[model samples]
Target: MPNPKIFDLTPPDLSDYIAYPILIVSHDAGGASVLAAWVERHLDVGQCDFLLEGPALRYFSGLKIEDSQRHSRTSLVPSEVSRFACVITSTSGEDVSLEREYIQQCRLLAVKVLSMLDHWVNYVPRFCIDGRLCWPDLLMVNDVYAQQLLVAIPGAPPSLLFDNYYLQQQVAQVLQYRKSSALESTQILSRRILYVSEPSTDSRYNEFELLERFLNSIFNYDYFNTQQLQVRVRLHPREKLGKYDELMFHTFSEYSINYCKNELYHSLAWSNTVVGAQTTPMVIALYAGIEVYSCLPEVVEKMTLPFDKIRRIY
Candidate 1:
């Protein structure tokens, strides 16, 4: 079978988003945030539809999505999606098995599909099935490295590779929004350390050990014991609050664990240092001029985007 035709269409104005809505999907909160930021910039309130699942529901809970337009993946039927002008999704490795079926289904229905790269790692894993790739009609990526990787796949269409200008635009827009919000906040920390935590769901890296190492790194630091350094841990959407509460309360009760209140952009603005393994927020922090440290040990190779390559962009 031949590869589907890929189009590198120029994005239209906000008016096009309202007049011709699209379906947005993502499996993680961070990925969903990126999508939401783009939607906020391009689509008017209640103008678009979403098939949010996994962490996306939690991340977008605060946004005002109409009940009619907002739906879970399971709730979305073929007939419903067939009407969409196009489908846009942040590729997910865990959901690929299901996504492949959905992709095939969409193909039969003649609905166009687009996949957005959430990170640089797993470039091939997210879309491949049984050594064969399930290609979308359009692919959005931030850098040329990704474009090169995607086009190398057998039967891949190079024309499908387009830059995710929305993500870059979001960074600027979010930073400006949070900068103004920061002026109104009275809370002060001599040194704010934002610890972005990822779930240890997979056994590649030990969650407890990672946390222990991070804590030790902080406590043993020259200024940590002093009143100057303050640390706050932001849990991933997939992480349970109780796990961290128990871990921190017994080992280090002083550290604060935040869930919904910890907006990624606001935390990045408030923090002097952003520490994490390999998360989208770390890259965002790096772009925002905040210092970042990789906490994941050597064993977890291929699990995250290469920070070295991402740093080159800045």
Candidate 2:
């Protein structure tokens, strides 16, 4: 159970609006991670039913929920949604329209809907589907930064602050890993960097191009030997395999490059430095006390990440 006093701004009690047998929906990994952490911390496992798709299914798989169901984009029907008192969904960047569809259905049925925002960018576009806005009754955010962003939007739904239990849990894991390894200092002779990759949505440069620029800039530095520098590219859950293979082969062929196959904590533990363009893992790496860098190359867009510790290498 979550301690209510932890937050300076207390959100309304779930019991006030949410009834038993609540439905939780998420399609992307980022939203799924937030919703899953909230569920583990706040909700009773017996009273929640999860409707998950894509990477969300993987995130919720470890939960001991008996009523969880995995569905394709179109398989879940509107009739099934009427059974729940309220619907909770995570805003997704993917092209899937199921979340908007659910919000539409919930609106017609007069059931309350709560939507959670996982990232800072794309505040309004996430709820817009097919030129129609499917605004929820209430919006939830984990940080003041996200809440401020939501509140700035004209006629945006009421936003509430909640603890980012997912990030908190990850930070704890990273700290424990550090303590167990007894790693007081990073190895100076060899440098291990984990490049966390995300699909380029709003960036002027594509993911591959940005990565290429990052590699080129770092390689030009005269201090480190090429053999001693290792890079492991960790792909986003939405990204497909072999997405960066061509770039790895042709552009950064001389460097030691490989895909990260380990879990997130293990991968972070293996590296002294982490790089990405406004991805959540980079924030996690920053919290873990790893040297973090943002690789935005010639992009005119302002950096969305609110952390000052993340050095902009571009």
Candidate 3:
């Protein structure tokens, strides 16, 4: 489905197309963030009439369900949705079979399912972000972002996409950073560090083991022991792992974590590293200049990386 490269935007290109309320879907929080930013810009450029996005597609990495639900603009379906983008995207959880089924229902009503949004198509989206006057079939992006995307969809091309990793990353970052009113005293990634996991292989608990170990290693500073330290851990959104009273690890794999805090580029900058298995975070971390480590031991040794630096992947 790869098309010859075309660099210029033409009027004839968009004449037959209509934004027709887009519904964005994905397990990637960062992917949602990119869409939000793109939509706002697209609206400003008068691209589509109105883009209708679902709840999970717009959520940031961190936050409580209650807080996110309270925002009317962010809510997926309040009362009416004329047209939307239905993205059946996710890396960890099995594809939302229900959401995929709903795609046709929404499309029958005029919503569009944008399958390709290769963020790494040509270049990183400069916040000088502009609107997509015409919906992109194979949205061109940068090689950097493209590298990250390959992890999520191995065969995926930088210009050819099946999901939005940008929004997913955004949601993850927001959820990781946002503090709910619950005031639960749990220490989280305060340092310039990154938490990594390999969802394509290990189970949720296995990731938890490494996460707890990582946290204990970092939090138990000069004066603290593992027991004395309080850590904030954002588990893989794909891992609806069991509850963690034993550790302050936040389980976000089951339900989408709430919160739309910042753009993917900005938040990624804060993390010292990007951790994942066959997931896209590693590529993103590299693009954002954050170090990346593959938690999936099996793949770590086999995959090629641009930099010599490699993760344990175990």
Candidate 4:
């Protein structure tokens, strides 16, 4: 998939963000919403500002969290930094280079930095960039598994770790929402399958090759030939389908191939199985009680995903 053509890559105005005492920064929709929910519950007015990246900001445009879902005092913005209090950010460890500018600004401002774990991978590089370790004052992990993995990093201190109550609650709430929506669906003919696609720019794996392998796995399956399922491809927020246009046009003529625009929770609700490689949506799928399968190449096993059994496609 190609990147978005119309996104505003420019950094948002940070003045509004600095007005609040606490700042919450997130680059992904899941992390931003989770942080937003947390801010709404714990922080008071003038206490916190929720800052999101361009992709995350656009993805949350129409979705409204109920008054009850948020605290009375919370500000949501598109940028961040400052000296008032603390700055909290989440990272899955994949895009450390991209966040350097923001992180640097926070450092220069001497803002207390708190980093939240997005998933159980890239432990060392996620926090330790440019040979500097313990970049954040506080590091939050979602579960015991994350804690274990993070603490094992050579020089990472144990005292810096804390449980991510906000993420835990978000996971529970998302699961409940998906579970409730399942009863409302009336479509009974086509068993839906969600294919969560990631960008191929990363040096670790080729998205095109992995996609080909996944397609071959499904086409060779005798049950898939029965045409009892519908395949819905959900592109990563930062990804576009331009690269897959040719392949999609040439194949799956007998079956339905849809590009999902709804949120991942909704996508999980509409699907029976989720396929991906080291993606957080797979974790969300499992939380929503949907089956998940791994489609990563053999050399990509370095990805330390949180799943217990990520069944390989081939």
Candidate 5:
């Protein structure tokens, strides 16, 4: 059996994150949206800003949180700081590697670290990682991959094998409507998603082409239930020079795929079904118990058994 995942207690009440505004930097494709949505839900009072490297500015800003999600008191973090934090936060075009001394310097200056659950540790070099296990601050990551998070802080509250509270909360919400009678009333329309994409120069495989081929092949096949399907293409975000756009098309799809109402896990959970290749959205769809049909049959065969035994493994 695999070892139990570890969780960490972040020093929440530190003077570093005191009265000053918090610049939450999110660098991955939909990572900013996830962070912003979470803050809007849980820490509405914190003065927050979204930092962007130049190319990514247009894309993340395009998916910015609406004012409706903002509470009455939260202030918009200024642009200068946003850019400054973004540059300091951003590492390189291919990977987001934070310099240990640089991050420590930011810590000394009281810049609070704001990052997605997956990329949070990349922000800090001091966190511990031992092959299968990587401890980012107090957050418990299952493996060196750093794909998942705990719902509760270690020693603070008991949590399930999966730790994301928002995920837990959202699961609870969707599950409440799971009964037979409940299913009858709810018109669960599954949208056909076009995880539209290109390939990046850095990646070994052009994920965009692979995913596109996947979608083109299986979307019309009878294997997947299409009762609620409405297919659409993913639109890439606008770009700027000098910054690493999450949408940078050395490759698309995973890099800058359009996430409509059909996608899951990035932000704005999709009610529709996923139609694409292997990626983050696929993982999230399985978690949501939503319908998933893969273009890659071989990948599906290998991944399905482990997914079925996810709970038992932990």
Candidate 6:
């Protein structure tokens, strides 16, 4: 671990001495969102090349890239990448190997690689490929808590604290939506709950199991039975469309159960309460002044979200 570098309001000037175009790469949804926000806020779209796959392709859509294509780790040519000024990537999940492979290849080619981490968990494991730690030249995180976590890890790469422009934008969008919408008063009067689901990558519980527990807990409360409660579950981008079909069949009779059909802000605006384990959408909901709850089971060691405003339901 080294002393963390903190950047000010603006992103680092990557194009200062660059002679070639910058290459941006991402795979997972979380990382893709962060990288897409960074590129939109800081970089010149025309001068960058993008190699987006998975959910990243969706996030980076509508951007004007010099060359944007999906390529696997094996298809990434050394000679082609060596021509770039540098590589900027997002740290993806363990299952994804493209970012780690890019880091190794970039290192071998002496190309400066900067990797941005999207979430707070799995700091060390993100860079571990084939039992070897593939440290980038610099790792970027959004906040002080993430910076501290990375610094605590043994042999962690140097990290930079950059502003989370994505979250800021989301907050702004929520505020703008609330001001323009006429149904804000009525929405607050109703008991609309939104459960944002995430893949249980670091937890012992899966989405279905946790959601069942949540449903059971709410059902026991007498107030929920009397009130007109509307419940909707928003699945993670990685989750399949019909992943919660079985759960819906069993719980539909108890309450008006449905899947979240709208976008993030739209869903938040319609809900007065949002629940999740440690997903990022819950954070957005909190920023929008919605009631948030952590529904992690008792079997889990502890809650990972660092926000004190989020109350624990279990």
* lDDT to native, each model: 0.63, 0.80, 0.38, 0.59, 0.37, 0.79
- What would the TM-scores of all predictions be? 0.72, 0.90, 0.45, 0.73, 0.46, 0.89
Query: Of the candidates numbered 1 and 2, which has the greater lDDT value?
Result: 2
Quote model 3's TM-score.
Answer: 0.45
- The digit string of per-residue lDDT tens for model 2 on 1-314 reads 23334345555655655776688888888998988888788777677777787888888877886644444446667656888888889878848776777888888888888888888888777888779777988888988788767656888877777898998888888778866886536645478889999988763778888888788777866333555788899999888878999888777787789999778887887788899988999988898888998888755446888888888875
Rank order (by TM-score, best first): 2, 6, 4, 1, 5, 3
Q: Can you write out model 6's per-residue Cα lDDT over 98-204, one digit (the tens) per residue? A: 78888888888888888988888887778888998888888888887787786678777666767888888887887778768864778756689999998887547
Candidate 6 worst ten-residue window by lDDT: 1-10
Candidate 1 per-residue lDDT over residues 1-314, each given as its tens digit: 11334324453332322234677766666556656655565556465677777776775676688888877657886456677776767766654354555555566677776666656666566767667666766665666566556656777533333445445754675568657877325335466778788765467676777777777666666534555666778777677776666567777766553432456677777777777777777877777666777777766554355456332110
Given candidate 4, what's the lDDT at residue 190?
A: 60
Per-residue lDDT over 124-163 for candidate 3, one digit per residue giving the tens place of the 0 to 100 score: 2211113312222233232433535433543332233224
Ranking, lDDT, top scorer first: 2, 6, 1, 4, 3, 5
How much is 7 displaced in model 5, in angstroms?
Answer: 5.9
Q: Candidate 1 or 6, higher lDDT?
A: 6
lDDT value for candidate 6? 0.79
> How far off is model 2, as Cα RMSD?
3.9
Query: What is the overall TM-score of model 2 with all chains considered together?
Result: 0.90
- Residue 156, model 1: lDDT of 54
Task: Output the lDDT of residue 100, model 2.
Answer: 78
Error of 5 at 282 (Å): 2.7
Q: How many backbone clashes does candidate 6 have?
A: 0
After superposition, the stretches of candidate 5 with alpha carbons farther than 4 Å from their true spots are 5-21, 41-104, 107-114, 119-202, 219-230, 235-272, 294-314
In candidate 6, stretches whose alpha carbon ends up further than 4 angstroms from where it belongs are 1-19, 66-75, 222-226
By summed lDDT, which 10 consecutive residues of candidate 4 come out lowest? 69-78
